[model samples]
Target: MATTNTTTPRPGGRSARVQAAVHQAASDLMALRGRAALTVPLIAARAGVTPSTIYRRWGELSDLLADVAVERMRPDSEPADTGSVAGDLIAWAEQYRDEMSSEVGVGMMLDVLSSRNGVSVEGRLPVPCQCAAFTASQIRTIVERGVERGEPVPVIDTVMDTVVSPIIFRSLFGSAPITSAHTQTLVAACMKTARLLAPVEL
Candidate 1:
């Protein structure tokens, strides 16, 4: 008789169950002990998977964190077209600021930024910044709408800077998070600089 080749199944098989358990455990640990206390051994023990599983899948602490953190963070969803560029822009901006200032949103921001901001491991950059990218798409959509109307829209980069930079600065540095009023004011101010930015009720 030939001997059978039987290998014990890897813990959780890299399926959704394993990933969910690992992700949940990682977050719970982060909340309890802070990022400084994170480690493969610690996470493995917490996640109930072997150290090899995490190492093979995630490679290192930063990579594991970036993976988990990105999974949890969500950017504001794109708003439906309101048939006016300024109106659309103001609506999206309000949603964006609200998302960023919410308790859940603030925690997500803290989780990602606190995890070394993509410092590399084995020369590999940490998790990609997909969290705030959806908001940028809204900006593009608004700018292109103005362009289509034959309005002299500012360049996309300029429009983004004019609209987003100050809001982020205030969110990160100011005593209070930005409000819908704040975003509306910025949107109105940016509109003042271009024909594409024609005044509209925000």
Candidate 2:
């Protein structure tokens, strides 16, 4: 078990530092070694804390991994409002592409979803379905904003199915690289398809 010797306190206290350390360890491990190798004991060892500390804080490895997955997927900055649905969608797709390409992001997502039905190291669902739901919500926001601006209402699911799903699918399957051009094309096509699919009011 590779372990780090440095320890620093967060503003809160020992508990905060412990939690931070645990997450840091998880991220580092997942990035260095693919998801299958990430374990609670390994994370604890990396953090220079006892395995009991991780268990006490997160209860299981899965739970910790899930939280780590969510944290990794979270956008570094708010979604860009580019004043055009096409531009906005392209920006969103690019962000997703960036995350999917990173070692931490891609590895954690694959591991978490693989254990979706099983207990994580924390003894819970590896990935929370809410993360997907939240992503859908962001799509909805983009659609609603477009409608308000007099752009056609967008088909939320179609966009998600076409653009977002493929990236994850390809990453997990070890298929061809999902390049920037692929993301741009998907966004453009989805935006057009969404307009056609949106319900038209009388």
Runs in model 1 lying further than 4 Å from the true structure: 1-21, 24-49, 59-62, 74-77, 120-129, 195-202
Worst 10 residues of 2 by lDDT: 1-10
Give per-residue CA lDDT, model 2, range 103-182, as digits (tens): 65666675556444345578665353545655666676677678777786557778778988988787767556589998
Return the TM-score for each candidate structure: 0.64, 0.70
Least accurate 10 contiguous residues by lDDT in model 1? 1-10
* Off by more than 4 A, model 2: 1-18, 28-39, 45-49, 57-59, 116-128, 196-202
TM-score of 2: 0.70
Candidate lDDT values, in order: 0.65, 0.69
- Enumerate clash totals for all models, in the order shown: 0, 7
- Report the C-alpha displacement of residue 192, candidate 1, in angstroms: 2.2
User: Which candidate ranks first by TM-score, i.e. highest?
Assistant: 2
Tens digits of per-residue lDDT, candidate 1, 1-202, equal 0001122233455576777888889889988987678888898898899989988877777767876766664332445578776787787777667766666556555655656545456553343345445445556667667777766555555556777777666777778987778789888877776654543411
